[model samples]
Target: MTIIKFLTLTLGATAFLSAQSSPIRSCGKPLHPKTIVQNDAPSGTVSKENKIQVALLLDTSNSMDGLIDQAKSRLWNIVNTLTTLKYNGKAPQVEIALYEYGNDGLQDENFIRQVTPLTQDLDLVSEKLFALKTNGGSEYCGAVIRDASMNLNWDGNEKSMKLIYIAGNEPFDQGRINYKETISKAKSKNIYTNTIFCGDRSEGIQSFWQSGATIGDGKYFNIDSDKKVIYIETPYDVKISEYNSKLNDTYVYYGSRGSEYKNKQMVQDKNAEVQSASSSVERTVAKSRKNAYKNDHWDLVDRAEKDADFISKVKESELPADLKGKSKEEIKKAVAEKSAQRGQIQKEIEVLSKKRQGYIDTEMKKRGNPEADDLGKAIENSVLELAKKKGYSI
Candidate 1:
């Protein structure tokens, strides 16, 4: 071919490859982008610097349905607690990894499955957690812990808080992998391994659960997994829920499967609502915090905020139908409006959430605050203590 023709073909191929790799895609496309423009998936260093990494290893054996229920109800509460921590007076990035064990998964794999790798996508985390099922199988505490430690992209910063919480009723030393050695390896990497026994406290000690915590230099707690979680209703909850609805309206989604992911967000809201009024309210409050519930990967408003040139570079075909023919200036203006509106909604939710929390605290004090140790409380308490030790302020 002639030099000009060869150059034309090469440039055309380059453009095609760029479009395929770009997270920005045409609407109604089936290829859902995992990140933003230029594949904005958080790199380990960009996302994990001063990050709080939490890995939850829960046993999903047949008899542990109650434990799963508690986890579902309190996932938002745990997230809210983590959002309270501040490193250097700014919110630290939070990433959570989830794993299920003792579920009759695959025997060769030791009945373990890494549900989701550590991710900042809180909606995906909730989706995976709600989908978890239970079945009888071997509970290998050591193996799960080892898998989480080795597989997750944990933050290496000494100031970042790294934690592993394993909750189960089985003996801690039941796995082929040595619990003591695995926990020691985790500690060597500055990761604290917390053990939450689902049965009686003394039984947990007798079963070597306490030893696991001691070796890893973390907290040990035993909870009644079968007990129901009590939620306190406050007058502020209603107003907060109303604000949450408005907040949801401000998200502007683009790219492939954007609409599906948007629907998934609403479904998760319903899931929390189905759990209880308090859970729904807690989730709404968590969503108000940008540091806790980020959707920059798909939401145009968030992406615009993070990348100043995103609105300018986005192609007309990549935009939603309503925005397809709009000018770049018009699109930017629309995103700016949604962002401001969201900020107002979030502020309203935050004010009401604080009042709601205060009311709950007062009621608990009046009731003498019954000691009801459950999965969420176990993780929340331990996280607060450990975060403080890492010099993070609440």
Candidate 2:
């Protein structure tokens, strides 16, 4: 399985202008600005650092609202499951890329929209998931997979698990690109491609969904797209939610989008809650995971702590109001204080989350629903199995 890596680059004005002036092409056609960005990786060799990169290509065509809903509601559960994985006693970083295909709302030239490049920023992933709207359109599984595999900076490390899970209800063979070639390209790069058909198993198998998985050495699953997910609430839910709120207060916002990012954090918090209390709890659990709750891009505390010279690089005007006018030493002290507070909250959430998960597991077993084959479970099971084969453990 090939894991998706999100590369954030600070290119020179010349390169930036060139990329802006020329249109990005996918399958020899001009890609929509919102669809894909070409050559986004920083100039250098691709890193072989161990991590799990999974690209989720979903069909957002009409009558697939249930599929989208399942994704939105179960994302945190997937994160929580991934967090438990360890390789050589060290936790591997997880990055996810999102693609939405087969939506009438999108352009025909690129019916597929790269909702996000491979990214470790889970909040950004959540925001993108929430923004998806379903509409009738053509579903091109092969084209999207080829685009992602060709365009994204996938690490070439055989030790890393790189995977593409394309979920749709349409025939596997569609559009201009050939499914066989796409799977072959993925295999050539050591990327595993999985197929998830949101319909009957036999129908999916007959439609080439199972064959797609077989070609790429990945799993095939057919799920009832409209199945309602039931979550068993635990006694730790309230405390966990409270700690999540406290966790938010500890963030020290900075940079131009500081306030906006902070607000987005809260918005996602509410979005999780709206899905279900259990979903919110799972999200907080994800936040507590090691290497999961990163916000160095917009948070002054994280930036200052991660980069010793972060304060020196930023202009005075760019600093948050509270951080402004303070000496470097004073600013460092403030950030340290908030960091300590955040760490404490995260520790508490971690402890409570473990208990919550245990309770849910016990309840599920008792209810005889231990074998629920929902979207999250299917993805988690496949990822864990593949990770284990690649020397990872839970």
Candidate 3:
């Protein structure tokens, strides 16, 4: 099939004037500034444990509503995929950062905004993602790619799998920054820049989306952004959901925003459920893996697990109402009980999740298992392929 690459260059006279002005409408909260830390460790040594760092740069243009919906639905599934990976017989720490570009609601010159920095707090990531809104704006592929590469904290471990996935329908070479140069810089930092074009394969190739991936030594994929994500129902889903509810009851909140963070966890649960039962199940499965789902910032059980002196050092006022009046010894015992209960509940969910996966796999084979051409599948395929090349195993 013949491909047509359209490069439209229309420089509005207002571009320069509006560059210094605020956005006409609010995009979200102010972007937090982060210092860029480069990984300088030698490639042959293991100074620190391996980690998986992924940055998602999405286009929130007026016509990309379907793409956003697919991302929301597939997030938990993506998380589940990561949980299955192991490096040197141990699960690596997973951090995800989010960025939204090609939206006029943003005040930046490139119309790009960082939704969240690379973080282990999955709930915060979910919260920021759901808050994104689309607006008609110029898509600057090169500029956003450059920002994500230079801003977020990327580890320098040679064995670490660091990736940047940028999805959009615009020409890959647009904007003031050249994609080739930006992507080359990313490669020097051991970051692969994957490109997902929300259109036909030929069109994506012609538009230079494929080139973006090639330049950064990463994968290029084309997806039908308008396609609806379908989920297969399994009999094990209901039981898993019940166990997930019991698991939620095992968390002990602490800190100033302890109650608020706990509420956010439930809110993210509802958000996942809103996507589909399959998504909710995927999230519960992710939560069951202690290696992937961690809430040390707010949950006393997780905090104590990481820091032995946390209980003794924590002020009583920071504890939840139920534990505020209790002595440190009593608090420690309570946290221990909750941790033990959480561990057992997690095991039950993990077993059920395995059965659930088996059922889904069998059903898929019966139906010929057509490939899903969406945001999640694109990332999953590329991640596994690149991760294996980095000497990691799934």
Candidate 4:
């Protein structure tokens, strides 16, 4: 071939190749690889450093004051820990929801409340917990899970994960709301239902709650292991150690979220610290990243609204006719299919993220803070390089 002709051919090929690439946001650097990008589809780090909607269904049964207080006290640490995750340049996206069940009984049959929808506002969750009170009954764990499944505006979590934390003294199986059906719904959406069994000596409690967790693709923890302020007077230590072990075992502790909630924290102090963290240059990046997550989540909601509208005949056909009230295991068939659509959408979001990042960079430059720029860039560069070394090519 003539040299000129060959050069022309090569240039054309390159342009085509570039066009085929996932469009990256031209705004900022691709988060230096080390930082996580919001909306990275599953990248196997949903629990590690990405967005997750965590629902805390506490058991405020007459027998469980201890667990409620412990949950309240632990909120800040949990938030601090989650914020440390850098999934795709974004802090772990978090929206913690709350519910109370097993506290009401067959007379009223069931009572459920969504104290908070999925939200990044940790303080709101804490405030809601403060109002929690012990109610009636031996436990109706199923009701809470069902409520969360039926109510909360769950994030699609195709880009993240949805976790249901159920703490109660009763066996999960014995309730009007079937635990099996709840588990099914969770599985279909990749929603995990981790259990925190609080009561004692109930027959088959282990099988009921543990099995629920198993089928739901989640874990179960002995609430007794988690130190409860109410339980300290009873001689048993809150097994925060055991709790940490589960996170470690599952690799959920990657960003030091486990450590942040290690001890009692005064509300004022926790809030102050969070505020300070918010203002730090490093934190500013994290905040921006968090906002990126919100944008992406809404993007998915919009897509789902458009694609199936989540209600198209095609979408409805994909759902099991008897899909209603299915347990987590039974719901798996549907979740698997939806995953493909999510994967495609996620790639698009990643490209857009890169472009958006460039805009952020431009503003940083406009600030004209040389040392600050150097520090941010240096930090970002190291993170991205390390991520690439780790095989992400970020």
My TM-score estimates for the predictions, one after another, are 0.87, 0.86, 0.87, 0.47
Tens digits of per-residue lDDT for model 4 on 1-394? 0000010000000000000111111112111133433343433232333354556677666766666555543443233223333445433445666666655532345655556655644334545666678766656667667767656656553545466766665657775778888788767876766665553324325548678877776654443423422100111112221222222121111112222322212243344234332111111222222222222121222223235433222232333345445554444444434445444444443344345435544654566623211111212232233333322322
Clashes of each: 0, 8, 1, 33
RMSD of each: 13.3, 8.8, 9.6, 22.9
Q: For candidate 1, lDDT tens digit of each residue in 142-210?
A: 988888887777766787778888889888898689999999999998889988888889999999999
Best candidate, TM-score: 3
Count of backbone collisions within predicted model 1: 0
Cα error, residue 364 of model 1, in Å, equals 1.7
C-alpha RMSD in Å of predicted model 4 compared with the true structure:
22.9
* Cα lDDT, all candidates: 0.72, 0.70, 0.74, 0.42
Q: Which ten residues in a row have the lowest lDDT in candidate 2?
A: 9-18
lDDT of 1: 0.72
Q: Per-residue lDDT tens digits of candidate 2, residues 1-394? A: 0011010000000000000111233333322211112332221112225766777888899978888888887888777666565555555566777788888787756488777766767788888888889988888888888887887657656777788888889999888989999899888888888888888899999999999999998888887778876677789988888888777877888767778888989999999899888788888877765455567778777677668888777776777787889887887788889888877777777677767777877876788843326677667656756765676555
The better-scoring model by lDDT among 2 and 3 is: 3
Q: Residue pairs in steric clash, candidate 2?
A: 1-161, 1-162, 1-163, 2-162, 2-163, 3-53, 3-162, 4-53
Error of 3 at 198 (Å): 0.5
